[model samples]
Target: MKYEADSPEAYIDLLPEDRQEPIRRLRKCILSNLPEGFEETMSYGMIGYVVPHSKYPAGYHCNPELPLPFLNIASQKNFIAFYHSGIYADPELKAWFVEAYRERVPTKLDMGKSCIRFKKPEHIPYELLGALCRKISVSDWIQLYEEKISR
Candidate 1:
């Protein structure tokens, strides 16, 4: 995929009806709590919240145009995915995510380096997920990637 969404609204509109609700709910949860420097856009075929690489310029994998994104939630063709970079970016957050996922999700969900997949809105723990989304301030996220590369 080209990884482009015209706007958050348009992106959700593209998804199927069943997909729309979960995406909408997730979008609401994320947008309501994002940090100041973070931006929401459609990227990678999903709703990407970019943590502009400029604010935390010292530790980007590439150019400074990139930002530290905490979560990238997208309504895929088959499922709704909640990508939380914090799990891999910060160890403490990873542990917390594990505990939260186990305690709240209660499903044998698959995981990527930082992505957590769920089939629907009911699968997500709104409050815990909201808290997770809120924790990734631009500064903390930048420090997270910096700490990653330094290792």
Candidate 2:
């Protein structure tokens, strides 16, 4: 579901009461473990963690005016979605996450290239997500973005 909000707080407020807490926890997990320099904002209608234009002057390759997005979390129609650009860009990172997720969670992983969908909020693995957040730093993301995604 696409929510129209100006800020992360507003986005959370717009979610259903049942979804708010899980999204809040997910947001906290990302913020607590995410390395320095990524800024939180509303990007593509979700709560986005991004490399601000101040840090990456060229901004996002698709749209230069917007910040370069690193991660995003959203409450979707059928599930909660956690999007991490690093896993999509880095094969080694993706493999590590896939293996780690299997070790930590009993359920089958419902994942796309960058989006991991949690059908049941209770099944959302906060610890694994936090570790994933820490796996890439701002400079490292910029380098990977340029090399693999931005072209």
Per candidate, the number of residue pairs that clash is 6, 0
| Model 2 lDDT, full chain set | 0.97
Q: How well is each residue in 54-100 modelled by candidate 1, as lDDT tens digits?
A: 56554336544455455688776556788888887788887887887
Candidate 2 C-alpha lDDT tens digits along 45-106: 99999999899999998999999999999999999999999999999999999999999999
The models' CA-based lDDT, in order, is: 0.73, 0.97
Error of 1 at 80 (Å): 0.7
Candidate 2 deviant stretches above 4 angstroms: none
The lDDT of model 1 is 0.73
TM-score of each: 0.84, 0.99
